[model samples]
Target: MSELSKQLQQLQREIKKLQRAGTVPAAASAGDESKVRFTAKGFVSLRSKLGLSAREMALLLDVSLQTIYNWEAQKSAPRAEQVKAIAQLRGIGKKQAKARIAEIEAAQA
Candidate 1:
């Protein structure tokens, strides 16, 4: 097999092991519903699942547009704060944590 094919095969095996151990979400048996695959490399399967553009992701992430471009191009890695924000947007953080939480609460009341 070609190097890329071998790499993909390896990744598939690793993903299967993770699924068996309940560490990763397995692909849907029906192949209709999208699955979120969280690998150890911090490359969540958000791009394929959400179909969001880089600019949209940057806006959701509250980071600079250039930052997103840099990340996509591998010119830079996400800083700690950016990583946290991404995790939050990905529904991995405390839901109530928001930049304008106080304002939102006041408006609701």
Candidate 2:
């Protein structure tokens, strides 16, 4: 038991060091979903960064066009599940996002 505890402690110390080095997002290592926050600025920035239009973002996020507009306009916030979906989108690049959009359109066909 002592050996196992020591190994766990060592792993945790490594994680903390990685976090401090900015290699890991703090909330991710902390396992706290509530640490995810929604902001219109962030939403729009992420949308434009992915080179996606509002409609494309809606498709990628499995939301409605109006919902995309609402989020960008700060008229409303995403639900918890939607927030998780949005968080997942943060890691991908434009090409991957476009591919995902294509998948969505194909499925809709």
Question: Best candidate, TM-score-wise?
Answer: 2
Error of 2 at 108 (Å): 1.1
Cα misplacement distance, residue 104 of candidate 1 (Å): 13
Candidate 2 error regions (>4 Å):
2-30
RMSD in Å for candidate 1, one decimal? 13.4
Q: Model 2: how large is the Cα RMSD against the reference?
A: 4.4
lDDT of 2 by residue, 1-109 (tens): 9999999999999999987765665566778887898889999999989999999999888889999998888889999989888887876779888999999999999
> Candidate 1's residue-wise lDDT over 1-108, tens digit each?
599999988988887787566454333312333233323235335533455556556656667778777776667777655554454445322322333344444665
lDDT of each: 0.53, 0.86
Q: Where does candidate 1 have its weakest 10-residue lDDT segment?
A: 29-38
What's the TM-score of every candidate structure? Answer: 0.41, 0.74
Q: How many residue pairs clash per model? A: 0, 0
